[model samples]
Target: QQQVKQSPQSLIVQKGGISIINCAYENTAFDYFPWYQQFPGKGPALLIAIRPDVSEKKEGRFTISFNKSAKQFSLHIMDSQPGDSATYFCAASMRGGNTPLVFGKGTRLSVIA
Candidate 1:
């Protein structure tokens, strides 16, 4: 599979709450998993990621739980804050060669004050 699909085009959560988003991929050739956070008019920045060898990875308030068997992954934002409000994307890529990263359509997250 060469595509990663994300859901809930948008999300709204209260400050200090948890926000969750899911994604699925079809390509088994993909070896790298990365989640990116993007603000309006800015480039996406890597948030967290996990390879097929690992079940999960976390960075501060962000966590990425991956399922290799299911070909799925999710991003969990803990202690959501207004500053965390932004568009999140789940992406996949194979190392080496010219395999460009493939991204999901994106999920817009808004944390209300």
Candidate 2:
């Protein structure tokens, strides 16, 4: 069962613009939400994350806006640059559940100059 759903399999954004990727989950048990950024031939790395207790979390140019009641969340990349182009995956896990994170299919983002 796919617990998380992500939209826009691919995205193209011009430099200095914003790139948004959305995701939704039905499992209310999820308490931890994280977004991972993966470059070509490299493993996914933790980008930013948010818990149900907060509505948003920002780290530098990356921000995660979450809606706990709606069971949805999104990643917003500000001032998108070509170097930022990568495959982004949204994931969810229950804290201390000992269960691996459930990931979305992924969105390939291409930022043009």
Candidate 3:
């Protein structure tokens, strides 16, 4: 079974719009949540992250909203641009452990100029 669930297998957005991606985790022990963005032919890079202790976190145009009680999380892209088009994955892992992160089925976003 997939540990994390994501929606909107694919998405297309106009320039300067908002792009949203959502995810949910099955493991309550997961305290660390991270979002990764990947471009074709390149490794995924960390975009933003949050912990159960926080409700939300934002870095520039990228934002992460975490809900511990709901066991869910989401990524929001503000002022979506063509350059922001990429595959985004929501991941979760336990805090203070060597365990690998569990990633959601990625959401593919395309921004039209």
Arrange candidates by TM-score, descending.
2, 3, 1
Cα misplacement distance, residue 32 of candidate 1 (Å):
0.7
lDDT of 2 by residue, 17-97 (tens): 999999999988889889999999999999998989999999999999999888899999999999999999999998686
Error of 2 at 88 (Å): 0.0
Q: How would you order the candidates by lDDT, starting with the best?
A: 2, 1, 3
- Give lDDT tens digits, candidate 1, residues 1-113: 68799987999999999999999999888888889999989999988878889988888988889899999899999999999999999999986846799999999999998
Query: Pick by TM-score: which candidate is best?
Result: 2
lDDT of 3 by residue, 1-113 (tens): 33999988999999999999999988888888889999999998999889899999999988888888888889999999999999998888886877799988899999999
Worst 10 residues of 2 by lDDT: 91-100
Backbone clash tally (model 3): 0
Provide the RMSD of all predictions against the true structure, rounded to 1 decimal.
1.2, 1.1, 1.2
> In order, how many clashes per candidate?
2, 0, 0
Error of 2 at 29 (Å): 0.3
Runs of candidate 1 with Cα error greater than 4 angstroms are none
For candidate 2, the C-alpha RMSD (Å) to the true structure equals 1.1
Which residue pairs collide, candidate 3?
none
lDDT at position 40, candidate 3: 98
